[model samples]
Target: MRQAARSYSVQLAIIGSGMAGFAASVFALDRGIKTAQVGNTGAVAYTTGYLDLLGGDQHSLLTDPWRALVELRQHEPRHPLARIGEQEIRTALARFTHAVSEMGIAYTSPGETNLMALSPAGTLKPTCSVPRTMLPGIEAMTQGAPTLIVDFDGLKGFSAAELVANLRDSWPELRAARIAFPDLPPGQVYPEVMARALEVSTNRDRVAELIRPLIGNAGAVGVPAVLGMHNPDRVQQALQQLLGVPLFEIPTIPPAVPGIRLREMFEQCFPERGLTLVPQQKVTRIDLTDAKLRLSLRDSYGEVEILAQAAVLATGRFLSGGLFAGRNGIRETLLDIPVTQPAARSEWYRERYFDRRGHPLNRAGIEVDDHFRPLDAAGRRLDPRLFAAGILLAHQDWTRQRCGAGVAIASAYQAVKGAVEVIGQGSAATRG
Candidate 1:
C-alpha cells in the first residue's frame, strides 16, 4: 500500500548528491539560503578521495592547473570550467574543502599546482586536494625516500608489489611489504572493514605492531586507505605514533575508504546545519509550476516530496543515472530536457578505442546558458527557476581532460548563485 506523502519546503532544492550537488549545497549554505538536497547513491564513492581540478590536457599531465584553465578557456569556451572565472572556481574549491575538513575529514586546501597523487593502479594523477593521510605519500614519492608500501594478506585490488614495480623506475627507494590484519580470517578483505576496525584502539595497536617490524629503515609507510572511517587523521596519527614512522595512504579501488568517509560525513553533517538531505533517494517526479517546483520520490519510510522556489540540478552523467543513453538517443532522465548530442548514435564512438579525442558520446549532456539554466531546443531557458550544474552540462569531456571536480564544483557554485538570485526575485515579487 502507498503511504502518505511527506513534503518539505525550501528556497532551493538540489538534485544529485555527487561532488557538484554537494558543492552547490555548500555554496547555498554559505549564502544563508534554505536548501534541500535529494539524490540516489551516486558516484561519490567511486572517487579516490583526491579532488581533481584541471589535471591534464590533450596529451600531457598538468602540474599547473591554473595555466591549464587559461588554455582551456581559449580552446574550449563552451566547457563548464571555462564559463566561470578562475577566481570563482578557486573560491568554490576552497569553501568546499574547508567544509569537508570542518565536518571531520582533514583535506589539504586547494593550491596553485596539482599534487601528484597515487592511484589504485600505482599510476600518479594530478589532483588539486588530497586527504591529509595521503599527503605524506606524495612527499615520500617526491623525495625518493625509503618508503614501504604495505598491503594486507587478504586485501585485493591494491597491491604493494604492483605499486613498487610501476614506481621503481622513478622512485628507486620504494619497497613493498605484506602483513596480516588483526583478528580477520585470511580470506578476501575489504578496505571499509579494515578502516572501521582501525577506529578501535586495540586494533590500531595490533596492526601497528605488525607493520612496525616490516618498516625496517623506510622513512615512511604507505598503506591502502584503511585508516579510521570517521577521523582518519587521528587514526593515522595514532598508527604513526605506534610505528614511530610517517604513515600515508594510497587509494584503494572504487567505493574506497576515503570516498566512503566523504559520503558518511556529509550524510551525517548536512542535516545538522539545517540542509534537508535525502540520502540515497532519487527524485522520481518533478512538477514545475509558475510559483514553485514540486519534487517527488520514495524513501524507505514512504513517499516524500520537496517544494522549492528554485532548483539546482547537479545530477551527473550516464554513471549516476541522470543522463540516459537510449536506443534512439541520449536523454535527460528528469523533465525530458533536450540533450545536446551527436546527430546520430553511430557517431558516438570513433573507430579506435584509444582515440586521443575521446568518444563523442562523453560530451552528450543538457545545454545551459550563462546563468546555468537548462535551455530548450531554441536555446531558451527551460525554466527561470531551474538551474543545472556538474558533468550533466553539455560540451567538453571531463574524463579525458581530467577536469571532473573542477567543472562540477565551479558550475555548482554558479548554479547556486543563479538560484539565489531567482529565489530572491521570486520572494520580492510575492511581497510586491
Candidate 2:
C-alpha cells in the first residue's frame, strides 16, 4: 500500500481550551496562523455567560495593567511580574477581545472596566471583573445606596439571611428581603438551576405571576438566589415589566455553570478554524530538550506524546493543577517553570477559607514577563519557546477587579503574538 504523506504540520499547540486557550487560538488564526487546541471541560458548559471586568469604584485599577502587575509582585512578593510592560498588556487585551467578537462571542462593553454579574439571587453585583486583584466586588456593593438582599427558598451555598445580616451590620441602611421562586423544583439548592431557567425561560407570564405581589412596597427587588440563569437580559426585562422594580443578582457557590457557559462559547469556535482539541487529557510530564517541547499526556484516547515548537500553559492554579502546591508550598507543574508563592501553603490562605480577608490561595500563583513567558527561579526566561497566559501569569486578582476574562483575553493575545514571533516565518514550525 502506498503511504499517504502527512496532511498538516501544527504551527502551535495549545494545552487548554478554557478562555485563555481559546483566545490564544483566535489570536493566532486572526494573524493567519494555523494552530491546534486541546483540553477538556468543554470551556462553555460550566460558567456564567458574562465576561467579568474590574468593578468596584473604590479599588481603581492601576492605569497600566503591566505596572500594576509589578506593584502586585512587590505587595505580595510571590507573584510573577518580570519584564512584562504596560503597552503590550493593553494591546493584547484590545486585539484579543476584538478577535473574540469577530469570532461571534460578545463582551457586552468596551474599555478596561467592570462587567456587572447578575447573581443567582436576582441581585446585581458590580464585581471588579478583572483577573487577580485584592478588592472584593461583593464588598464593593455596600457602597451603593440602600442595598437589598434577596433570596429564593431552596437556594444552596449562598445564605441570604446570613449575607443580609452581615450587610445590615456593616451598613445599617442596607435593606433586605426574601422572595421564593414558585417554579424551582423542591430540594434544588443550587440557585443556578432557577437562575438558568429564568435566563431562557419562555415563562415570563408565570414569573410575573410570582413576582408582582412580593415587590408591592419594596423600592427594589433583591434576589440573593438564582434570579435568571442564561438569559439575564430577558429575565430582568420580564421581572421589571411585572413588578416595576429594579432587580439585582448575587453570586452563590461556584461550579458556576453560567460562568462555564461563557467558557464554552469560546471553546466551540476553535475547532472550526482547524485547531486540535483534546478533552479530558492531562499533561503528565513535560521536557524541554534540544529546543523542542515534549509533552506526555493521557486522555480517553489513551497516552500519547505531543511534540511542538511552542506551548501555552493555561492549566490554572492549584484547583486546576497547572501549578501545584505541596507541604513546602507552590511550584510549577509540567515544565517546572518558576511560580511565585508564600513561604508556606498555610500562609497561602486565610485561617478560614471563607474568612474574606483574602488569602494567598487567591494570590500566590504564577509570574511572567511582558509577553507572558515563564521566568526561572533566578528571574530569567525559562523557555523562549514557551509562553504563559490566563491565571498562570500571576499577580492581580480577578475576584477583586472582576477582570478575569479581560486579563485572560489580554494575556492570551500577547502570548500568542510572542509565540508566533518565536516560531518566525516557517510553514512547518510546529510538530503535530
Residue lDDT tens for model 2, 1-432: 543322223667787767777778778888876676666664334444455433422245334443445555456554332233456655656666566555543333344434444454334554323211111223345455454555666667666667656555444545555556665666665655566666654655566666666554455555543445433545655766676756654545567644554455455666677666665577777677855577767654455666677788887665566777778767777777766666765577667654544565666666676667788888888888888877766665666544566567667877888898877744354342
User: In candidate 1, how many clashes are counted?
Assistant: 0
**Residue 152: error of model 1 in Å?**
0.6
**In candidate 1, what are the lDDT values of residues 286-350, reduced to their tens digit?**
89874789999998888898999999998998889999998999999998999999999899999
Span of 10 residues, lowest total lDDT, candidate 1: 283-292
TM-score on alpha carbons, each prediction: 0.98, 0.71
lDDT of predicted model 1: 0.91
Best by TM-score: 1
After superposition on all CA atoms, what RMSD does each candidate show versus the true structure? 1.2, 6.2
TM-score of 2: 0.71
